[model samples]
Target chain A: MNTFTLGLVVVIYLLLTAYLGYVGFRQTKTSEDYLLGGRTTHPFIMAISYGAAFISTSAIVGFGGVAAVYGMGLIWLTFLNILFGIFIAFIVFGRRTRRLGRRLNAHTFPEFMGKRFGSRGIQTFIAAVIFIAMPLYAAVVLIGGARFIESIFAIDFNVALTFFTVIIAAYVIAGGLKGMMYIDALQGGIMFLCMLFILVMTYVKLGGVMGAHQALENMAELVPEGLRMKGHQGWTSYPAWGSEWWWTLTTGIILGVGIGALAQPQLVVRFMTVKSGRELNRAVLVGGIFILVVTGFIYTAGALSNVFFHRQTGQLAIEAAGGNVDRIIPLFLNSAMPAWFVYLFMLALLSAAMSTLSSQFHTMGSALGHDLLGTLFPKTRTNGMVITRLAVIFGIVVSMVIGYKLPGGIVARGTAIFFGVCAAAFLPAYIGGLFWPRTTATAVKWSIATGIVASLFMLVFMHGSESAPLGICKALFGRDVLVEQFPWMLVDPIIIALPLAGAVLIAVSLLTKHESALDV
Target chain B: MFGINSCGIWLGYLLAVLSVLLCVWYGAKKWNKDDDSAADDNWDSAETQLNENL
Candidate 1:
């Protein structure tokens, strides 16, 4: 907790990050190198960078807090992350993405889609969506990192936010994807080791694994009165089937994030960074283990923190953190671990935030500069690197402004909203483009358009979780939600829009003429 | 199995462990396989055309 020690640790970490950024900058010789790391990234680096970029403060701090409240049932997300995010994503999606990206000479996700279907309009539309929606996600991550730094360093939030933004911007602009990957690998390693240490230390503090879990189950009677009414079961157990809690856990958090990861622009581009399917295959081994330790342990540690709090203060984790779920993990860390580990965990968190932010900035930059502007104004294509670097700065500035402007509650929903929107908007077309050769460009256009429109509509009107907070429905319809009925209000936007979009795509593709002879 | 009583929660934990194993096995089996070369020849000219257009 010493200011001098904390300052020294941060300085060393930043200095190391700068060195990696410089390495990436020196290696980038062409636009291809800046955009896709020249298609020769190492498997270990690719996998770790992908995993680190995929996870953020949202997973560790935000979702970890949710686990403290929701219990180990959140582990289903971990299982799904490995099953879908790593296994299917790498083997099924990653292989095809690399092949198709190379075949089309596409550097960005939007460009891949645009070239695959031979429609620059499709490319521009997807890029526009990324530019508009991604800043919200970037802003929330910015705020999360800044808030943590504010709490730990006793600095102004503005100072923390600017420091975090500048560090990420420097690396991403100078090094591009290649530089970002190197930093991501380092950050990922710190995160994996720190999370492992916390998991082991937590279990040790609370008897052992089984003992800790059993202790949690024994305190089932202490479930908050309000939560029990909504089908709150013990922490170690799944929520009651068909209960409100079950729907929220299953459909909202688990399905929203778990399945939504496949189509992420930032994550997808990592697949295109490597040379061949062999590298992707090799990456799966490392990515699976990385996700398991980082995600699995945090969710487990979050749930088990209840036992520690209960033993120490006779209060649940939520109560111990004064009912703010966000504080539970930090409170547990400060209380349960030794002082030095807290500082190390802080570094892991900074790594988490920076890794994710770097990718977000890079993706946003490419979307605006490479995909949208470069396509629409052909002359801008000549200065692609300059345009992209300036776009990264624009993204950082937009995100920073939004970080200051947006209310606190909406920032918490930012990850879910962005993930759900991306899945609904991109997943159907992404799958069709990758696997189904019969898929028409017209079908992709409609599917993508429907996905974006329907998801946003659902968020604004029907899905109570987002709709209530957004207050647009209340302002317009004079009601909290468009539907006063049960479950409709509870459902996540992804559940409705993703299927509708897919159905539209399939139905339309069947009826329309096949436009391209290109086969996957 | 791990002192968690719920069958569903236990299944989740088991599946998560199983998934990691699956990735390891698949990766090891296919580590050196080059599956893209056959397709690379077909796309060579198309890739060239696309690059020129850009």
Candidate 2:
């Protein structure tokens, strides 16, 4: 790549972001405008912004790389993303979130829950969880983006991470959610085409789709000995049913992310941004299509990259690319793409990274400032904008510290932990609150608390893929799990905690039905 | 075991295409979907005191 061309592309991107930030700052007169776009965002912008924030570097570079190592089994996530992330989210959860939020005049996700359930404790607790857990997610996105930049620009990882953070943090602090959505929409468009190009070009390089899958399937004999020990069927097919691989794929990636998307505070807020039910309804197609292309292509291209690597270098994508799963996509592009194509692709990855990072920081800031602090101080609600801005800076500092400390190969699983935790802790109450009018505040409160406690307990002491690095089970119990080969240890927390959460909520709601507040 | 065939390989993308069509189809059918904008306006934001009421 020509240095001038690369520098020019970045300069243009930076300038455009600055202009977008300037526009957002001017438009944000009230906290309503700043936080929720004054509830008048168009459907196209809302859908694109939601999709962009929903699918970031984690989906493209992180999960895509995982697909390269694990084969196309990760594609199930794409199908589920459309079904749950788009359809169920926009049609089911989003409608109630928007309706109830506007009805309650709630501005933040926790505030929505707090108001709907009529409990300040609910707001504070969930806000605390976001402030504490969200940094890990932010760090993984930072690492994923920085790693890609480091690979291409030949810069130190710290420098790349810092550089990425500074640009996004500045814009997010100035623009808020309105500013973030505009940038997200722009970046989402860039990501759409770039991902499309990557898929088409990759398939073209390795013949066509069928030819590529056939080629990948042909390499099944080359499955690593270590993986084969744990029920490694070839990459293209689903893992052997009931095998460890199947457990990992079905529980960790597919169910973890698919269901998790519905409960995200950041995504839930986007539904309330637009004007009316019809506006949100109109967004269904746009969000679905954007997710289909960006997520669908990345997973597909990731799986097929092994074919390119094997045919060229006679090694699996991971081993030949220095064993860093995160580096597979970058390495694949460097080896196979033209300099110009690589240059454009870097911008797409940058867009993907920035779009999500800004959303994470913004949401975390709102959680701390608008929900937690606002509940405690209440006076801060008068100057909520200032508090939220300060909280954004605090979020960036925490994420930076985590980004610096994080080890390699933590990208995909790191993202999954945040998603799984959110699903386990938040999903039950959120759904119950929306659909079941009989869902009591006492039940919601207990359901959320117990769900979070159980999820945390499971994550720390169990041997699921996300918590595999925690080493708590091994250090304390001298084994991966307490009970040898426990099925619970292999699956993510949602499988256990979600059911438990529902049961607790249902059981408690029924027990308290005679004294229910809704009846009053 | 589906044997890593093209169906297992291609099912996601095919389903994704179907999902897009379904969303678009449903969205078009509901283009005149019932307006819930009245609810937002009916509840005044200036001084509702929903917070205190809670």
Candidate 3:
């Protein structure tokens, strides 16, 4: 509404986040406190914190925009998010990971890998990769948040970007993971309330559920000529079962986000923050309910936006936002909601972005400072906290540059790329290390190496777009590279690469004799 | 206005709430027993390890 009101709301939210960070800082005493909240975080806080970190601006802005363009079929992703991202993640992965982490006394993801496999070198390599790749994902999210601020406040993009980055970095550098999780829990609650309100309001604004569905069904006949030619018949119905649209929906959206959750280093580390399996078990329900509201509401509202905007403006809201799908949700909120609600929604969106951004920055910083450099130069003995703070600053700069320079429309693709790499490079070894007693350290090491090398080589050499990596796609594939041609790459490296990595681990473990000095 | 989608959403929430309540009940029941002797033994071992490290 008014500039002063909006500014006041923003300032108040920032102060609340800073206060939480201060509280976390006060409680933090050792590396354990900074890394894992001293392993005593309450169950409810841990659950919401984990959910908030998992469902970032990426899901709300990026995936929501995609849903607006693609139709309600993307709602399946929300279902998968609750089932896999929350339920399976907590039940299947969280309990075992917490136990193993305590057993190994590992704090960060890279440290977990290193200690599990008994190889300092493997941990260093994993840390280096995380440091290099995660910033791109972080930057894309920063851009999403900044763009919303620009739209609402009429602020410069660069200025908004810098402000968002600096605020998140300050608290994260000060409070570490404990600060990040406390703020995340609060943000998660805001996100749930905002989504509930938005969903109810959207339906009310559209008359009712039946009326909205009827309107969407009727609007299908009026599908644009270009979309019809490309096989989009309507927004009312599912895409043809065997069509390219169906493949993209199933492979690209559903499997990409769903399977990718397993290997997310940020989410995995949340397991280490609790004391026992019971705490993780308790968190499962909270996480599931949080996802059900947050993701379910976002998808529902996004799909309904098609009906609202099309009836009013004779076009989907995404098209109205100049084809930048990520801006669709913000644009809709600006147009549809009351002025005060817009400020509230902005706060929710900021919470979504900052919550995830803080976690990503913290994870990346630890990867660099504690895992990689710490392992490689063991005698350097630099203060770990100082190195981590500097790494956070470095990460912010890298992500900012990438966010500004990368061509737009890449947020969705960039998310797929990062998640795919994680699933491939880490999933096999991580799973085997936990469940399989015979998984040798050598086998684990080679599997990780193979998975990372193969996935990266595919991304750079075979899968890159025409402008990527010196036109290597045209040279190799004899056509401008299509992510669709090798759709497996777009899905997750895990499905293919995990099995391959598993095979290598098994074969190598079988061939090599067990060492007499093995610690385990 | 509360239709199938709302019903589904609420059902999910109820299931989650029930699960959480059960977990809290179970945790409290298990951990609130008179196990101070066992705890003391564990602490003694930890203290010995700390002394060795120092």
Task: Name the best candidate (by TM-score).
Answer: 1
| Cα-based TM-score, every candidate | 0.97, 0.93, 0.86
Model 2 lDDT per residue over A118-195, tens place: 888888988998999999999998998898788777899999999989999989999888888888888999999988
TM-score of 1: 0.97
Candidates 1 and 3: which is better by TM-score?
1
Give a tens-digit lDDT track for model 3, residues A403-473. Answer: 88876556567777788778777887777777766777787778877777766666665443312644666
Model 2 has a DockQ score of 0.44
Runs in model 1 lying further than 4 Å from the true structure: B45-54
* Candidate 3 lDDT for residue A499: 67
Using lDDT as the measure, the top candidate is: 1
- Cα deviation at A500, candidate 3, in Å, is 3.0
Q: Which lDDT value does model 3 have at A356? A: 83
For candidate 3, the docking band is incorrect
Order of all candidates by TM-score, from best down to worst?
1, 2, 3
CAPRI band for model 2: acceptable
**Chain B TM-score (each prediction, in order):** 0.69, 0.51, 0.47
User: What is the lDDT, from 0 to 100, of the residue A70 in candidate 1?
Assistant: 81
